[model samples]
Target: MCYIYSRLFMFFSLLLLSFSVYLIILDFVYIIEYIFIIFNSVNITYIILIDWMSMMFMSFVLFISSMVIYYSEEYMNGDLNKNRFILMVIMFVISMMLMIISPNLISILLGWDGLGLVSYCLVIYYQNIKSFSAGMLTALSNRVGDVALLMSIAWMMNYGSWNFMFYLDIMKNDWIMELISYLVVLAAMTKSAQIPFSSWLPAAMAAPTPVSSLVHSSTLVTAGVYLLIRFNYAFSSSLMNFLLFISSMTMFMSGLGANFENDLKKIIALSTLSQLGLMMSILSLGAYKLAFFHLLIHALFKALLFMCAGSIIHSLSNCQDIRCMGGLVKQLPLTCTYFNICNWSLCGIPFMSGFYSKDLIVEFMSMNILNIYIYFIFYISIGLTVAYSFRLTYYSLSGDFNFISMNLLKENNIMLLGMSGLIFIVIISGSVFNWLMFDTLIFICLPILMKFMTLLVIMLGMLFGYELSKFNLVYNLLSKNFYSFFFSSMWNIPILSTLGVNYIPVKMGALLMIFDRGWFEFYGGQNLSLLLKKFTLLQLLSLNHLKIYFLMLLIWIIYLLVQI
Candidate 1:
């Protein structure tokens, strides 16, 4: 049943992809608008903006989702709720498509809220405590973004319309209106898991790999980046600089955290977080197109990377600790090949998908006269990317076999079939997207020293990774220090978010309950009701005798005679 439904979605997705391809070839933009609701002067409508960007993004999403659905057949072969999983994934893709086409804030909420809710469902699909915890975190963190978007919508009421496309140019001159960009950036930060919101991305690994592949890699996480891309025209210089700082810190922090992570899936999740930071940072630098370009390319390789991780995990009986894996190259030759290709692309190796987008972003950042902090974080994060890539590669493919015994690790054909599609794109997506999106390569003049900084850092990172892998006592010893605990625990953001954010509110609620039940209800409500009852009884008692009624009648008669 699951297979049938998955194949049906794949077929439908392919058809959508074909339509998108045709739209892209013609360079056509199709806009559809109709009034959804009208109240006095304010009119909310359904606006779908379909252009090269939307069609391109939609096609990519459909293609990847189709492949993910197909891949899940074998990966989740015996799972009882495989159909539910497939359905959730398809719904996720639909939400992404809605998000991709809408230019209106109200319409965007449909997709954005859909993504947050569906991702939570998918994350908790495993029905375990870890999934529950992770789901709550993922949902709550993204909920912040949802609230921000809602606030932006409310703020947009100043313009008398929800369609931001019409207001971007005019918004720049209005200081109060420009505040929407800050709200948008705040929303983007949470959605992209920047800094304080960073904990959820790594914890989201509790979800199944397919969810990680589709939701985390491309759709759910990148929604914020996509939103910023749409809102790029309205961002003030101050907002951009602020976004730049936050995103830079996010990129650096995720990179540093990845270096200390041992869980294979969490490491990849951290890498995704780091790449997200890069995209956000570039967008903050006012290069929306470049950020969008990287978003697409990163989606390709990161999906493939997660799929490879899933395959390896499936073979290893669900083991995800990189320390437990070694010398897989000999056992899972094809899987290792795919894994390395994706890893190399992630490192931004020349001619690969990541290089086209990532290297250009860095080069452009270098050419711009930015602050020293931005410069340092950008370059260091890039190098850290390579460092973690090497560390992951060494631990999984080249290190001594740490498994207890020789184990069977045959490649699953169906899984490989799904990966094969991405593998081809991982190799060609860069050149293809570059040709399709840009008329000419972005030109930047730099000295020889600057030109090769990325390479130099990558090499340095490799050497550092290799030496650290061997001489780990010092790094390990350093990791035991107080600051190390902070880094390893993601600066205790998870604890803060879960414990810190939740504790005060929960405690306050308990105190409120005590007040309500003990004092407020007893004295203010219950005792008040009892006092009213006693007063009524006293009034009745006062009128109990027939003489009292006669006395009242006589008083009324006297008052009437006096008035006459």
Candidate 2:
């Protein structure tokens, strides 16, 4: 049995390896496509090859999926769920691949929904109540975004046919085009977990570490920014500027939340959201190339960080609360090493991946048509980013190793080696991609100054954090249910007044609800004894039900009646 199991495992491992090679080949093909388009040798629309952004995205997905597949051999240790987990991982990769290559709106929506569904399953793979609840929250949040996409699709079909080839042609209708663009931005915001939709991301930390690393850092959360990049030409200037403001706000707010988080996973979760917000802000400026460039760097280092966190948790037998962790640097040296590399990159230190990408974003903000105040927002967010990165690195790895028992410090070289490789890549990513696009004076020097300023802020924040640890004031304020409070407060407003009295459906909703519920129950409960009474009432309502029961009943009932 052991021999058979080993053989089967080796076979599957080789299959995953082969897939990784195929993905690398695909990445090269995408690069060639970009070159072709750049020189006008091939029309960008005619070509079906993946673009640069998608290629980078696929590379991260392939790397992380391969790592997870290999790591699962030891991590699962003959558990029954091993097969199920592997299957989900493969499905996750396939969905992400579909998402990357999808060329049109309908295809993109299909891939997007597929990814959301698969990610939810992976999150709830352990069957724990908390995990299940987290998955549901993710699903609910994603569904809201899905509805916006559907509305955009409806608008598209109404203006043109179901054919996406008509998109460019339909652009002549400015109002319709702008409306579709607004809906698309709304959809992207929800999917990317910006502002009001951001709560689901931190909640998603309830999933297993591997799931978190893949979904939170590399693939799922990126879908929003990907959409924004894909449809860059559709949005109006006003809408783009609005998106820029919202994304910058999300970046700052999420970084603040990360600074206050106690759980290891929640900190990374918020950081992922913040980094994505930064990417979206760049995308909103029509800087698609730079946004994607930053996305590639962010994915690599963030995945490395999450995987290192996973290794730490696994070594300590699933302990993830950072407050309980002290000195782990000595005990988990390999993990700590990778964590530091990721932190350096995330903090935008010199010669790191984030320095190149983040500096470009700041440069773009400064040089773009945006106001100086907007640039200031981006600048302050950089400090917040550094502060949170330091908070994560210091509290988890630097304090004292004596806090964790010696017996719990088992090292898995496979996991450690995987993370180390990612860290090495993150260190050299700038040179590998030629991401340094600006002047040395502006890009390197200014960012270094910014980095030091940010570092000082981080140190001060840590000291304040230490003091607040005693009084628990900052911790409590950060942890307060701000999202819940704001949502509840918004709900308390009179919808009719807020939306305009003309927009309100009026009190007729209660009458309809009573009628529909009573009618359904009455008809459903009828038997021979009450059949006559039920039939008489049903006949009276049949005229009304006629509109609901036709071949196009749903459309008329939902659209026409709602409008009325």
Candidate 3:
């Protein structure tokens, strides 16, 4: 059943990819509307915007989803709930498609909320405490974005239509539009797992690997980036700068967190957060096209990365600790190859898919005259990205095998087959995407030293990663040491966003409950009931007094008539 569905989605992916190519070749944009409502002479339509961008995005999304479903055939083999998992994945893909094609905010919100709800379902699919907690975190965090989208919808209602595409140009000068832009950014930040919202992405690792690969790596998290891309025209300069700052911090935070993270899936999740920050930061710089370009490229490598990690985990009987894995290059060579390719690609190794996007971002930023803080954050984030990449590599790929000696680590061909579909693209998509996305050369002028700075930083990060990996003093690490615990705990964001955010409100609620049950209850309801009970005679008289009065009035009227 999963196989059939996987093949069907693959067919759809190929068809869309071909169509996207045609659209790109022609530089065409197609918009069609289905007017479903007529009120006060206004035509409210459900709008579908089909252009190169939507088509391309839809193709990539379908491609990754198909691969994930196909891989699950083997990865989820013998699991009773495999069919249900595949179904949920298909529903997720449909939701992403709905989001991709729709120009109307209402339809987008439906798709947005759909992704959140289905993801929560998928996250808790394992039916365990950890999975349930992760699901709750994911659902609650995502609810913030859903609420933001709802607010955007409500605010845009004043325009008489939910189709925000038409109003982008005019919104630039309007205060309401500026407010909408902030709401949209807030929505984007939550969905992308930016600062204050970063913990959930890692926690979502409690989900199955396929879910991690498809949802966290590519689809669910990127929804915010796609939304911003669609609504790019409405951002004011102030909002853009604010977004820039937030995304930079998020980028740095996630990169730092990834280095300290030991769980295989979680490290990748943090990397996803970092990449999302890059996308958002570049988008804020008004290079939305570049952002979208990076987005597609990142999806390819990261999805493959997660798939590769899933293969490893599935083979290892669900073991996810990096410390427990080492020298896997000897046993699972192909999977390791795939993993390394994706990892260094993520590090922006030259000529790889990640290289095109990341290098371009750094160089593009260098050309701009930004403040020193932005430059510092941007470069440090890049270096931290490389540091974590190397750290992951040193721990898992190069060391002596640390797992149990009696284990069999054979490769699963079906999983590889699914991954193979993406590996080819991961290698060549850098050059291919660069060509397709840019019609002309992006002329970046920088000095020789500046050009080498990226490479220099990457090398430095690699050295730092190696040193961290070799440092035998285990007690000095982030989660252990008091000083570095801040970085290890993601600046204590998980603590803050969860316990910190909830503590006061929850305490207030407890106090309120005490007041309600103890005092307010007695004062409002119980006391009133007691007073009524005390006056039982008057209560009974009150109940019958109306009938008695009516009878007396009738008697009086009869007497009066007789007298007259």
Candidate 4:
């Protein structure tokens, strides 16, 4: 069953890939616009904007989803309901496609809602307590974005249409439109799991790895980036400037969290969050095209990275804690190779897929005279990325074997087949994207110091990670102090997001329950039932005699005769 679905997705991906190639060759933007008139002066229009960007993004989504589907066959081989998993993944891909091609807010909302709901379904597929909690968090957090989108749609009604693309130019100067922009930004932030909403992302890792690979890495999270890209024109206001600060903080926070995290999947989840922050921050800087560039490139390697992690987990008896993983290179040589390639690419190693975009993003930021705070945050986050990568590598791959001796760690052929397809993309996607997106490549002139700053900080981070891993200095220091628990637990974001986001509302609900069960139930329902029962008992016991009925009838008759 899984094979059939996987192959079907692969076939569809191929079709989309071929269509993308044809569109690229023609170098033409095609718009198929249709309007359905329901009544007088009332119509819902459908705009299918087929441009190079949309086609390319759609192709990538389908391709990665296909690979993920194929990978899940082996990874989820033992599951009784793998077919359901495939169906959910397929539904997710369809939603992402709907999002990619639409310029209309209504269509975007449909797609956006689909993504959120499908993701929640996937997250809770395990049917366990952990999965249920994670699913709730994921669903509610994304519901914020859904509500924001709905509000934006309502606000757009002021213009008598939900075609936001048409209004992007006119809406820029209008304060009312500014409200819509703010709503959109908030929506994007939640979809992308920025800051407070970020707790759902790591918690979502309770899902199967194949889901984490496709949804978290490439499709669902990037929906926010795509939204910003579509609405880039509306973001030239103070709201966007404020968004830049928030995004910067989010980026820094996620990177810092990744450095302290020990769970292998959660660390990767944090990295995804940090990269999202980078994309959001860049978009806030009005570098929307550059942000899109990073989005695409990040998707490629990140998906591959997650699959590699999945493969590792599969071989290691499903243990995801890096503390219990080491010397995997010797056991699963092929998987380790893929893991290292993806990991290095993630750290933005030169010439890899990540480098082309990440380096350019940094240089672009450096070229602009920004506030010192933004500058520091950008560089420090980059350094932190490298630091965590180093720490993860050291703990999981380089150290002595932490797994049980009897554990078998052979590479699964089916999983490798799926990974091999992604490896090709991860290698050439950066260069291909650079050529396609930029007609004339962007060249930024930076001071020599600034030019080398990214590499220098990365190197410093590597040193820091290696030393910290070898000496146990950071662990010891943190364990002994207040900062240790805070950093390790991602500043208690998971606790605060779950307990904080839900606590007050849940408490209020409990109070409401008490009111309903105690006062309302007793007085409104139980008392009424008791009073009826007593009345029925009195009628049966006291009024059952025929003499009573006859006496009442005679009194009624005498009163009627006197009135006559």
Please name the candidate that would achieve the greatest TM-score relative to the true structure.
3
Can you give the lDDT of residue 430 in candidate 3?
A: 89
What tens-digit string does per-residue lDDT give for candidate 1 at 1-564?
545655665666567666766776777878898877999987767889977788778877877887888889999998988888888888899898899899899899889999999999999988899999999999999999889888989888888678899899886879756888888888888988998898899888888999899976679999999999998988888888888888888888889888998899999999998999999899888888999999989999999999999999999989888888999999899999999999999998888888989889999999999888888888899888898898899889996788768566889999999899779988998998788787566888999999999888878888877776776678788888888788878778889889988899888997778566786666687778878877895667576768778887999999999999
Candidate 2 pairs with clashing backbones: 326-400, 327-400, 327-401
Per residue, candidate 4 scores C-alpha lDDT tens digits across 1-564 of 666766776677677667777777788878787877568767767888888778778877877887888899999999998788888898898899899998889988778999999999999999999999999999999999999999988888889677787889876898878899899988988999887777888889988999999977678899988998899898766877788888888888888878767789999999999899999888888888889889888888899899999999888888988888988888888888888888888888889889999999999998887889999999999988998999999998887998788888888899999999889889998988788777676989988999999999889888987877787665766666767677767678889877877789988997678566786676677778887877785566575678777887999999999999
| Of 1 and 2, the candidate ranking higher by lDDT | 1
In model 4, where is the ten-residue run with the lowest total lDDT?
472-481
Quickly count the clashes in candidate 1.
0
Against the hidden reference, what TM-scores do the models get?
0.88, 0.73, 0.90, 0.89
Q: lDDT of each structure?
A: 0.87, 0.70, 0.88, 0.86
Candidate 3 weakest lDDT stretch, 10 residues: 472-481
Q: How do the residues 26-122 of candidate 2 rate in per-residue lDDT, one tens digit apiece?
A: 5444422132254445343322444444555666667665665666566666478777777787777778777777666666776789888988898
By TM-score, rank the candidates, best first: 3, 4, 1, 2
RMSD of each: 14.4, 13.8, 14.5, 12.8
- For model 1, the local distance difference test gives 0.87
Off by over 4 Å in 1: 1-27, 35-44, 509-514, 517-564
The order of the candidates by lDDT, greatest first, is: 3, 1, 4, 2
Single out the weakest 10-residue window by summed lDDT for candidate 2. Answer: 488-497
lDDT preference between candidates 1 and 4, better one? 1
